[model samples]
Target: MHIPFFRSFSRIREPSIAPEPAAEPAPRLGGQLERALGRTVALLQYTADSHDALDDVFTEIDGRSRTVIEELDTMRTTMEQSRQSAQDKAQASIDRLSALSQEAIDSLTQLSADLDKRMERIGAVMETIERSSSELSLLAINSGIQAAHGGEAGRAFGVLATRMRNLAERSSLDARQVAKLLDFSPFRASFTQFNTTLAHSIGDADRRISGAFHSMSASQIDMAARMDEIEAHTRAIPDMLANARDAIERGRRVLEIAQAGCAEMQNACHGPRALAAAAQRIGAPTASGVSVLDSVRGRGVLRVAIEPRAWGMSFRARGASQPRGLDIDLAQAFARRLGVAVEFVERPWLECPWLLMAGADAGAAADVMWSALVPAPIFHRVAFSDPYVHFRYVLVRRQGEARFTDIGSLAGHTLGAMPDPAVPDLLHAHGVRWGRDSLQAGVPRLKNLLIFPSLTEVFDALCAGRVDALLLEQTMAGWVCAAPDSPWSGRLEMQAAAPSDPVFHYTVGVCDDSAADTMREELNAFINGLHSVPDYGQLLKRWHIEPAQVQPTLQ
Candidate 1:
């Protein structure tokens, strides 16, 4: 059943006629939403820029690493080529020197052989000359003897022959000394020893040079192999870099998705923020400071004023005889946090607001009063905390009756509602076409409207066909339309009303005093804190309240 006291006080627009555009400038709510969205967008942009900067840094590092690898590779190639060229030239020079050494050894051997042959020929000639000298000496001796036999005339001839014999002996002696001087046996032996030593020395030099070249060639091959490995490893670096770049690119894409999500959140916040702004404007007080927060002392029992008449709002549980509604649970949780026990003060819904306004000397009827959608006029007398929930109007009618599909359907039809402070004004504001100006004026009643004093009477009238249709909060109507115990259930068609903007934000109320301001601030802080917790959604779900409704309560 719909609670008469808890029904939304906002006037739902009649959709039969299109609303004409007002000449006034757009609401500040739009500007507020825009500024909020702009800030969110700016934050997202800043994040994207930061990501871009990081990407640029990584890209630079990758490029530098690549450049270093390339340079190393080029240097390795140049060094290998130079080393190979130098080794080739060195080997060629060694080969030429070895060839020149071999030629010198060969020429020395040939020269030694020629020298030996010439010495042998000279020795033979010396032998021949010696023999000839000997023969001449003998001949000279014979001639000297014959001359002596010839007597005095032959004496001169014999003297000449003796002189010749002396010449021949001297000549033979000189020839023998020349043959000894010309001897080549010792020279040939000495030349043979020198040639052997030169050949050995040349061979040793060739071996040393070849060994050096062989070692150098081995070292060059090992170095070339190492360079090749290094080059191959360096070549793999670009692929690794490409993989890193791909990872960074993927990260960038993820960042972009995050930015897009932020944008979506920004867009979604608009409707809620606008609704909050509009509701605030509607109930914003012109004057304040008539209440204070001292109504409740620290860690002491709290006096919370609430109406327990509603079915699912703030009523007591049937079996447990304990309070079990969204508002009651919230209040109990809040009291627990304060280290205080709750002192529930039952009061009528409409009169609950006066509890906060009670005088200090009167012992302040209650520390806080909730959860009401205070009318604009009440704001002059009380202060309200930030809204914790919002509600939209819905149309309720009998199932077989003409559907109350739009505002047009209700244009000339009679509507029923439990009397409330803001209902008349809201109805008028929505072009409800009421014949009467005020309910308390005691004027002739309008055939198009029915104001009951209680929800029971309203429902009784709805079931009795005393009213064509009724307006209620969407949640309340849904409950009523579905509840088996309610008379309107199954028989009533609860059609959702559109143009749901400018919804009412329900809040806890306080007197316009110092305590009221403090209490409001504290309540806002507590509510804000509650929204941040995971249990916030759990609490809403436990009470079957929509979690989305509480999100706009953020101060």
Candidate 2:
């Protein structure tokens, strides 16, 4: 005999990674490239008043980004705590259910022992009945013998003997029946019927007990199953909450980074702006001997709003050689072509007028602002030259994340971004909700946001696995991701804006200053000539900012 003879074999499956989906629609793909080109144009547009200011803007953006990252981390921690609490509660329930099941098992075991004892008691009663019946049969035999000895009285004796024999026979039969059933007799001679009824009653009790036991078992099993499910849910919840907390911490980090970056950018912009101001004050002589390019000479001075370097831009796919984010470039070219010196000023995210005097009538600082101003800025303040460029805000995530199809998909994930009053307000405007369970159409995809100070930190955290994604304009994100020497190249992607979003535009800002009439005429004329000029168009194309599409073969 072989005490230990066994064969074991295992067939295991190899682990696999997730695969990318089929290519997107041709139009969307082209849009991604076009947006990339826009970033290059944004860079070309930055002409700060001083190097210090340029540096400050970049530093500020970074500082804010770092702060945001920290916030994301905190949010993740909170979520984990919540999940752990739920798991503990579920575990306690499971323990209690197990104890109840054990109690039921013990009760059943005791009932089995009691049943055995009852059977033994009935056996003893049957033994006594058997002994009594044997003794009665002997007496009958003796009575018959005595009757034979007596003559006339023998009849009575014989009768008595017969009666005794009959009683013995009946007693014996009763003992045999009691032996078969657990004896609980009604008669002194035998307890067969009573014992049989007792046995039946015991069986009924056992059956009832079994039924109750079975019910209890079922209930315990169900309770355990429920606890298992609850535990699983609770476990997952902690991780989700952890992710959310991490996102918040990441946001805080972004803010810190942006704050530091802002300080640096401010230093950089200061020197550059001062230099420009000094040059202006000293009146560096131009060949034309114009202190400032007066409107009378040609078009006039065009005030260009420069998006700080901290914000940055992208360089998309190559076409004809040109810089990207070409609208900013065109604005500069338009200013130069009109024989006007460009006064580039840094503009705030929302209020460009504060940076430059665009809409004011009397104390206006700059006649026109170029950067990316919406139509509202133009319509309310002054007429726009035209919409020179378009942009979008996009969400960026890890490279292999297929779970997120759109920004809305981020609802389950921790989202890190700078807290812009405009963002939440915009969501509120479109009836977007602000709770974890609250989801509806037209709402921004992420209700749980880890707000940061700047977008750069958001990107940093995403790359570092601190947060799931970063939010920014598609045009900027796309270009920066593809730019040469950019670390994010090929590792980043753009998410399309939802239909509920408003169009992002870059337009010319105008003012009602004395130079308004001349400024308007020159700007319109400059735009008409901008596209046809080789240098201007070449600049735009160089930046990969051209908006054209070409289809690719699908595999």
Candidate 3:
């Protein structure tokens, strides 16, 4: 009897062991199990990818929120300072205007008092003129009476007295006219009324002006108080943003936990799926074929090919058990997504792609090459994932070397570079020939070109003064010249070849085999997922990769 249930149970008990070759054929249950397992793993991976994207969005939002809060704080501080300065200026203007108004009022009052005193003196002078004219008239009348007593002799005296009397009358008339004209009683009363009205008007004007100033001061105080309230409210916005960031962080932690759970679930299905494949082999040995992804899962290890000396990308520190670099961290992250342990295979950068092309039986075969490899014509057989990081090529030279400015500056200088096809193409484009032994093809060819095997060796050549300058990647140059622990720190400087220098994209390369397409797609998904991850940027920072060296997008 062909018992299908017993066969399934037997396969599950010993998943690692292969089924006997002579075992009787069973149903196509193992093929179905494999398909189901593939679907489950795909769904879990999709979920993880979504989580990564969402986490990245949250992190961006958090960062922007912090920036907004900081800007708001700065705005609030500037507004406060401006407000105080404006208030002080306004207050000073008001005080000055008030003082000027009071001074004008005092001057007008003094002028009014002086005018009243002059009017009184003019009235007294008119009264004295009238009294003198009356006295002259009385003296003339007495002289006329004496002339009547003495006959002919008195005739001349009488004529003189008459003339004197006429003169006195004229004088009296003039004094009377002057007294009428100088009638200070009515004029003084009118002047007093005018002065009183002017004083009253000035007082009223002063009161109104004072009241207006007071009102203005009160409004300013109210406005200042309102502004204070507004500033206080503005100050609280940062705290609100902080709370939102905290919530986002908490959500991110939860998502991380969920992702971990999904990874575990995916790993748990590997055993049963392998056993199902073994059973399927018993039914039809040629029908069930393990994919590269499946093979990696079966072994519970992802072989990551890397160039250990690619500084800032992948390198092992002295006395460290594990390698540390941006590529190293990224490779480990990709391995974690597969629910497998990582096994790093060190190789030269140029030789890394060949390791992926090596067959499964090869000792140094790798599932993916995580070195900072660029897509080139030489590696046509290798499948490259989407770009994860990018950097521009730059010229690195010793400090105070004024001879080098741009790519054209390297014309008369010995330039050092590692073995890269792109390097030669770049040099050729700039009319600079590669190789020390090669004849100068042009007049302004490079003085000499030294090709080293690795980045470390190239850097050593530059440091040892064997090379005049180095054509290097921006991130690597920055790491070697700017890192505090670097021996050449502060002794070297990097300059861009040009403002429009081509950006070099770094991608993961895999063998272009039947199973490699699936692996490449998965690697691309993993790389794309890291775009929003904060740790991706932090990892680069830890490796001394500047933010400017990183590409915001895959392109």
lDDT of each: 0.56, 0.47, 0.63
Between the candidate structures 1 and 3, which one is better when assessed by lDDT? 3
Give the deviation of candidate 2 from the true structure as CA RMSD.
21.5
> Backbone clashes in each candidate structure, one number apiece?
14, 113, 0
The per-prediction CA RMSD against the true structure, in angstroms, equals: 32.5, 21.5, 21.2
lDDT of 2 by residue, 1-555 (tens): 111101111222222222334433333333322322222122112211112233433443354344345544544554455445545645654565565456556655765676678788777767777677777767767776777788766777867777777777777777666665654342422335444655565565556556555655565565555444333323333333443444344333323322322232323233433222222221211122332226324434555555443233312223524223554566556766766665555433333433232111222234465654555421223456654445545667677777766555665455555533345544454443444424466555542445544445556767765566666655456555655645676676656666545545445665433335455667777776655667755564455343212221210
User: Which portions of model 3 miss their true places by more than 4 Å?
Assistant: 1-288, 359-363, 434-442, 547-555
Residue 288, model 3, lDDT? 39
Give the candidates in order of lDDT, highest first.
Answer: 3, 1, 2
Candidate 3 local distance difference test against the native? 0.63
| Candidate 3 residue-wise lDDT, 342-453, digit = tens | 9998865654654564311224467888887878766635778898877778889988788988777676566878756678767766666533324646546654555565
In the range 402-453, model 1's lDDT, one tens digit per residue, is 6567544666456777535445655655655544343444333333455553
The reply for model 1, stretches above 4 Å from the true place, is 1-295, 317-320, 359-364, 400-402, 437-446, 483-493, 541-555
Output the TM-score of candidate 3.
0.46
Q: lDDT: which candidate is best? A: 3
